[model samples]
Target chain A: MYAWFFRELLPGPLWVRIILTVVLLAAVVYGLMEFVFPWLSEYSPLGDVTLEDG
Target chain B: MTPPLPRHADPAQRSVAAATRRQRRRRPLGAKIMGGFGEILITLGVLGLLFVVWELWWTGIEAESDRQDSLDEFYANMPARPAVSDGDDGDNDDDGPNPADFEVCYTLDDGTEIGCADHMRAQTGSEQIMGTVYAPRLGENWAAPIRYGVSATQIDRGGVGHYPNTQWPDEPGNFALAGHRNTNASMLGNQDSLQIGDPIYVVSYDGIYVYEVRERQVVLPNQTEVLNPVPSDSAAEAEFGVLTFTTCHPMFSNRERLIHHAEIVDFVPIGAEAPADLVHHEPITQMFYAGGAG
Candidate 1:
């Protein structure tokens, strides 16, 4: 399945396709770690330890 | 390739390719939607786990190292204390510390009683190490540096914070302190374990202030009275030095504040031998002077 997908979808040789896949995976992980997760964490109550009293 | 078979690639191969393409294109709408939703959920889960690791574990490691570095610098530059022969047995005949021995602060109106903390604070300015807090209940080696104010920069550095306006150690008022309950090294993570009469030692360059736990209370965050000269008794007069420990309650949650109050029972001068219970638990970096055991 992977071979078929890479062969049909990617416009490059096997080596180039492999490199593209790795770079794409890295980009997605970086985006989630650096941006998406941090924005979501602000809404999480786990790290919000401050008191509510004025 | 034997001359290309007109447009239909050999009936068998052509049929198989068409069937595969049809199956790929004919995925059910409900299945597609479910698959997309599942992917979203998995991504959310992975992100949540990563955040947990960052907040609970990575932050702790970073804060601990920062605090350790601060402690090392603070201790290394401390001046050597003057020797006093009578510090070892804990028996001094003077009604109060020798005026010539250390700077004294007459916080009360009488001007007779001396507050050693006034001297210590004067000696150690803002953002400096006010002292070292040792809680045997926390651990055999639980000692955190006490900085000047309560803020993320200070408390998050893996140490407790001393209220700026509150009384200093040995002062005839409350020496209030604050620390994190969970994140940033959680200096006071186990503060609730302190039992009544448990000795809480505050070690300064000048001397050690020993406070005995007398009570514990949970209060609202807005209740500033807990830090008053006399905790929860704003109008009541203060007679002796007291220590108060404040932290977020319920461990990981911060819906309430946990407070522990201790009364000063003794003061050990710089030259005195260290307290037996606190001897084993030294700072990560030790700065021993030629004149005293501190």
Candidate 2:
């Protein structure tokens, strides 16, 4: 899937493709960090810092 | 010889080409499957690692920014200190503004004054900044704004949060606050470093309430008795106010809560000199002295 994405989905020459890949990767990581991860953290126990009454 | 017989024009040559193509199409099914599976696994691994980075690092960045905004808003809304002239130093012998000079901002339901503790009952769900907390023992510049709610909307902003049901500072009850231990700017990241008798200063709009650490314990999340009017003793009436700090225990885990209780030792109303022990974080202490307001 990734190979297909890199080889076919992206356009341009090798150098342009490489830069595009970096940019795309950065956008994905930024989205995950700013949106997906924070929302997922709500359900994850990893960042549960508050206590509750029994 | 004649243009290589136009390759495909010859039936024999066409058959040979077709056979190779068939072989190429028939081979590597298993390898393709395994390769795809490995790619998926690698993608999942990278995503998991990124999630950890988000939790440990990215969250702090966002929270710190939020905390800064909260601090700025709190200071901006703070009442300006009474002005003093340099040449009139002899007339004003006191070091700073006198607490007695400021009007009371909070009182109990029965109209009894709560003094410099600034025991204002915040409306539920209003995530307002209640005060700024400073602990010299925690760090020379360690300070976090305490907000009204303990939920993520408040605590995740890189500051301590007051449990809604808990009492306010110097209110003759337990004033409980919560903070993240390892994430969200780790406001109380060094909570365990507190020592017995260490001073924790809570600077509210009315004044600074000084609390001295009295005890520390690890308790299950449900052991909320620590937030009782009289911590761990619901039956007993609180004779004086106490401060409680609650955070997730064992550093990176939230299986339990690390609790610290501090007794309110003194109160210095706004305009008065903060307790000598209070760490002088300029942005915080400046709000109390003349010309400190912006």
Candidate 3:
């Protein structure tokens, strides 16, 4: 739904499309840097701790 | 009347009919794209390998040429400081063993001394500095110095400025030669590839001169005193028969100019053994390199 909305609606104008592209890239990188997955994986016993490698 | 088909065509007819039907079944775009992508990857892989090979070849030329310069410079250095290294020992005068100290008696196009005031003050740019550069060691024949920028012409005709303080066919002393470093086809820019101790010869109607590389230095633009008749050193050294050539360094930008310094080794008279062509002058000086100074 988010991908479809971004492709069909959020890009209502050229300026908005440019802004959306920048924001989406920034968010993707930010999410990775915040270790969102690693933090959650740490609490789960089944998660492979060795994969994080400190 | 039977229009006959060749015997080979009869056997291939069945295969051609099968291929025709199969080809008539058009391929879907997605399948076609996948097949094309595979071919593209293969082509790109081969190209990348060839590119690597080309790069290696280019790198070899640069390295080999520079190595030749390095070896030339090494061979050019001295076994020991010629007796002159003892500080104020050698006469170090204009009369000192220089190939440059000679009377240059010749008339210019304007019917004046070889380097009359009007001749030295000639204008700069494409039309003016477009004269022949005759170096006896490298090549004895006169090559027209390419003026303006390197792009304007392949043969560099150096800058239009005078030797600043020297006479035409300059008297026995250090003579300064300046050229625009950023210009196209400049002798200075082409010299980026020059190793230390390379020999440079500049001949004219006056006489033929052989300049052996002495030192290379990067100095401020105002360091013009080096052009003094005698290079002002810490101690009173020998008077010079010097040829100081300057150009802006790094080829394009002129924040500083690289200087190549040499002393006149042998000033051959005009009708003397100067070869008619520069290419012929090589073998004689090939084994003879300049002596090193401290």
TM-score for each of the candidates: 0.73, 0.81, 0.38
Q: How far is candidate 2 from the true structure (C-alpha RMSD, Å)?
A: 6.6
C-alpha lDDT (0 to 100) for residue B271 of candidate 1:
47
Between prediction 1 and prediction 3, which has the larger lDDT? 1
lDDT comparison, 1 vs 2, better candidate: 2
DockQ of candidates 1 onward, in order? 0.33, 0.67, 0.01
lDDT of 1 at B20: 72
The model with the greater DockQ, 2 or 3, is: 2
Which one wins on TM-score?
Answer: 2
**Candidate 3 segments exceeding 4 Å error:** A1-54, B1-131, B134-160, B167-170, B232-238, B275-294
Best by DockQ: 2
Superposed by TM-score, candidate 1 places the C-alpha of residue B173 at a distance from the truth, in angstroms, of: 1.6
Question: What root-mean-square deviation over C-alphas does model 1 reach?
Answer: 7.2
True-structure RMSD, every candidate: 7.2, 6.6, 22.1
Q: Ten-residue segment with the worst summed lDDT in candidate 3 chain B?
A: B151-160
lDDT of each: 0.71, 0.78, 0.44
B1-294 in candidate 3: lDDT tens per residue? 335445456536845654665567658989777877887798668645544343223223433343344323332431221122333556555322333333544432343232212322342343433223444333333232312222212222222234534433344455566544433223344545545666666534333456677887776555665656665663444343576666665544554556667876655443234433443534323322122323
Supply the TM-score for candidate 2: 0.81
Q: Report the TM-score of candidate 3, chain A only.
A: 0.45
Residue B276's lDDT in candidate 3: 37
Cα deviation at B227, candidate 2, in Å, is 0.9
